[model samples]
Target chain A: MNPPVYFFTDFSSRGPYLGQMESAVLAVAPQARIINLMNDAPFANPRASACLLAALNDYLPENAVVVAVVDPGVGGSRKAICLNIGDRWYLGPDNGLLSLLVSNAGAENCSLAGLHESYMKAASASFHGRDVFAPVAGLLVNGQSPDTFPLPVDGMAGASWPGELAEVIYLDGFGNAMTGLRMRNLRDLQGVVVGGQLVKPAYTFSSVPAGALFCYENSLGLLEIAANGSNAGRILGLEIGSPVNPHISPGRSKNP
Target chain B: MNPPVYFFTDFSSRGPYLGQMESAVLAVAPQARIINLMNDAPFANPRASACLLAALNDYLPENAVVVAVVDPGVGGSRKAICLNIGDRWYLGPDNGLLSLLVSNAGAENCSLAGLHESYMKAASASFHGRDVFAPVAGLLVNGQSPDTFPLPVDGMAGASWPGELAEVIYLDGFGNAMTGLRMRNLRDLQGVVVGGQLVKPAYTFSSVPAGALFCYENSLGLLEIAANGSNAGRILGLEIGSPVNPHISPGRSKNP
Candidate 1:
């Protein structure tokens, strides 16, 4: 059986864009399980969203097909591409949004390809999420090989980007701040410094007192700034791309 | 075949709450097609959310099970109920959130019922969406009959409420404001007076010039206020539950 398809985009709340995307997918694979992983990706900031998409990779079900769209340059000269990382499939614009995913998947095991522009020849130039990428995702979920629609180029535009990012990537509804820094390798780290505030690491929300600010490994397996019973985003004045400094206590090794 | 399940809630944009609801549904029916209709419903205001949920009902597929949650009174004396409106199933709190649906379905065809509270005895008093409603929806989707889980009452708490509402029930991501008035019975209606501004109607976004405010039938088949190229919600300072007075043109009969 084909794995479920996960949709990640910047469509945010409201509008017909998200629903139309689902319709396009259902028209092809009527029974496919589609998950709206996150619709509120940092708007138009694909670099920040790239880190978010990478950090979210750990929470996805096995062999999921993720159709990610954080494209600010949709109708322009940017290419439309797909990447097959092991059993998982990633589809979206050729912007740097897929950089971290490709880098984390170990570029050696992944192959990048693109679709024919003719597929979207009739689509509105402004709404490619509904017209172009959704249909492409529908086709992929039906077991079509990415190599069947090859691009003129070999690698994605941002394939050479770094593996980990240190900036604030996303802010959740609860005001928790998620940084691009992976929690995999950090050892003996005392706290995270955001806006000059030292937030100590706790095991979970209940580990800290109500209204207390702290840092912890979130369900997505990344270091997130959170308050036990309040909105951390509002208190910290955090935003996408905000600089987050991971404070390592003296004599602690920086390497994982 | 079971129709897809649509999720409407006030969970906002982040947290494990919404995802955990999907997990509960998928656990019972692994291949269930779950759609996140909207998560940012008006917080805690079920009357306003009921109007929004009612307006959204037209856009849902046939026989779709909607697990609507806008319960501000969770873990209180409020009841958890389900309504079978034709082929569609609506499940959530008894705080008038499903009132519009029951009223629209004409009450007689819709029989009110509730699940045994023992099903939720193990559930956190806070999140019945994950523990109770989702599991019930999964059972219904897998062909369990509504008659199997009957409530003590025959009618919903808000069954006798008005069919049409004249309030701003929801605001979309594009900054459009959606009212609770259904367009089906609005004949000879020229415009809507919102915040003391009389906005005219247009066929589509392009029908008016840029930054023009107009009321039209939205994708959800409800009257909505929108700006051609600008944010209408920002321009009009509109919000959920904002009073909107519908203007029926003089000398035009009010008949449908």
Candidate 2:
């Protein structure tokens, strides 16, 4: 890892605090490989997060620490956990992020997934990614055990109520791309977004009419806008961090 | 332009010749931008060249002369011309490339879209982008006239034609992107290429359910192959410059 620590999050909260944590990593690790695994993970969908992780797991640097925070129940009784599974370590709220991995193991094998209170930093009502998750992840990457921070909290279930999956993270030039949406949720939708500003009219940029607004399942399996003769990005007036408000017909599953 | 003289072509026939011409541009016009539009244009489609032109049109420096070559009916009775539309000049065969620009302006109303013969190299074939086009574009950037060389071929009609609309060109890592095929040509596709492999399902490293092959429009919007859990690039065995066959789907049409 050229850059030792890799932090992944939805960037929902923790502004300068995140930056400060990054600075701490810089000072200590000095060689962190901070791969951005989509700061736009949907509000709180383990599937979306899992999909993203599933998509990127094979490509991440070997044995790199993957820190993700998609907590909607940040300051509740939810227990923050550190898990070691399949040669990788995950530190975050014991949300459903590990469900896929655990399910894959089939035998319910356990390997160091515990939440400790000693690591809590004032336990703010929100912002665990900055206060708890980031710091614990930093320590874990340096070869410290999950217990190095805290003892496993008992009877504290995480945010795992499989819900409606919604997300629109990245928009690229040609207005033909929007990455990070769960395609499984949108594949059946005949919906419109942005008050019909973005509509799924065709399958790809080619299928969409020129100068007409159209949506499709981009290879990323996310919603995207495109123009046959021009760029979708300029047309929609969006850049890296623009939010997508998709309006679907027949609506989505409320939670995929 | 920091680099002068751009080359966009398949270059199957005029590779070394264009290389010499490019060297000549840098040797002669160091202050100019010598961009590689491409050496991997599809067989013969002026619209493909046009898509490439548009993709780079906005990012180019003022007065930059873009040199392109997609001459299939080269030695045939096609006329050679240089078109000055908007703020830049395009030096290539007077084929449908300029026609693709019809959405903006007609080729007949060119500012300096004329022919020059005196600057032509002796014993040159119809592949002028190398011997004729590249040198001429370089000369103009080096400060010369539209008439310093040859007279416009009298009655050389730059008439229009109707075909697939060219929109974007691929920009590969080595500066060679297999572009020129518009989205109109890529829809409902079963398999295409990247790093020289037949690709289908688009999967992410982790999302891939172990041993699944993945194919998707890479970050660059060109078809790419990636494994969900492994390096498909290494597993399926591909490297840069390998052919990515984005074959025309059975339902492909000549329209967008």
Candidate 3:
């Protein structure tokens, strides 16, 4: 059996876009397993989303094909590309959405290639996620390589972008604010300050007083601001692109 | 190959509940195709949810197994049951969640049964969707029958509930309010009044002026109130359980 195909897109969960893309995958690989890894990514902000996407790398198994689409330039001149990073494959627009993942994997560990021209010819102007990326993923999981031309890492968009973002990149259902800064890189920090509030670190919600604001490393290992037993995002007035500053003690230096 | 497993639950899209339940289905039937039919069902209001579920019946294919989990009575004395309605199978708590679907299929066409005792014994108090319903669905799709006892139609909760509900039951990603009233059943009505605003019927969004509120039959065949390119739900302040009263001319009477 083929490996599962995972979708990570800015398409909100309630729309028909996700379902249409799933149908496009099934059209090519009828027996393939599909998972909606994350449908509610930071909308149309690829630079910020790249950091969150990299944090979710541990969830993708070897041989899995991930269709990452946060393209605001969908109908523009942005090139469609595929990247072979580690044992998994990523099919998406050449915009900065996949750049952070590629940079994290290092140049030697990544192979970048432009998707075949035929896909673009057949794709609709606005919805390349359903038209281009999803079908490419289906074919990849079916063990058939879509035609492609090799591209240099330097030519990729957002190749020089920062590895981490200090903004709230996502808000989960419970209204917890997930920042793009990885916890591993911020080990020296005691907490984060958001919306003029000092949010201290806690192991979990239960470890803190109910309704108290706290920050912790979420399952994806990102620093997330949450309120125990309450809507932290609403209480703190946090939204996508909200700034989050590291709170380090006077004696402790930030991660260098 | 087994039929696909569809999940209809109140679990919001951003949480771990949906993903964990998907994992459980894969564990039992490794090759089964899982689709998230609907994750954001009206939270804990299965009576309202039943009307929405019955409207979505057209999406299910023959032999498909749907795990309906709008369960608020979890860990309670409510019975776990399975219903073979039409050619599709449904596994959920007997807390009126699946009652409308069963009634829609007619009593003679439905076969209601209690799930095997072993499933209940092993299921966690909080999440039977993962432990009980998901595994039972996987077993059915794989052609293995879990133990069950026959049940009469009258034994089902909400079995005698109204065929249609005239309240806002769901809101889609675009904030369009979806009422439980089916459009087919209200052909004689020119429009409906929601939140004290008169909403006229139109074929689609483009037919009306931009930002104008109008009602139409959504793809699911239910009455939905939408603005041309804006959020009608937000503008009108409509939410789940908001009453919708049909507006008919003096010559026209309500559906009989």
Best by lDDT: 3
Q: What lDDT score is found at residue A16 in candidate 3?
A: 89
Query: Which wins on DockQ, candidate 2 or candidate 3?
Result: 3
TM-score of chain A of each: 0.93, 0.59, 0.96
- Candidate 3: which pairs clash? none
- Cα DockQ of the candidate 3 complex: 0.11
Model 1 residue runs over 4 Å out of place are A1-8, A13-20, A33-140, A143-256, B1-3, B145-154
Please give the ranking of all candidate structures by DockQ, highest first, separated by commas. Answer: 1, 3, 2
- Give, for candidate 2 chain B, the lowest lDDT window spanning 10 residues: B12-21
- The CAPRI category of model 1 is incorrect
When sorted by TM-score, best at the front, the candidate numbers are 3, 1, 2
CAPRI grade of model 2: incorrect
Question: What RMSD does each model have against the real structure?
Answer: 7.8, 23.5, 7.7
TM-score of each: 0.61, 0.38, 0.61
lDDT (Cα, tens digit) per residue for candidate 3, span B1-256: 5788999998787844676578567756777788889988997789988988898877788878999998566666788999987668999989898898877787889999999788888665556887798888878878888899888877899988988999999988898999988887786777899988999999999999999999999999999999998999899999999999988667755665
The superposed Cα distance between candidate 2 and the true structure at residue A197, in angstroms, equals 13
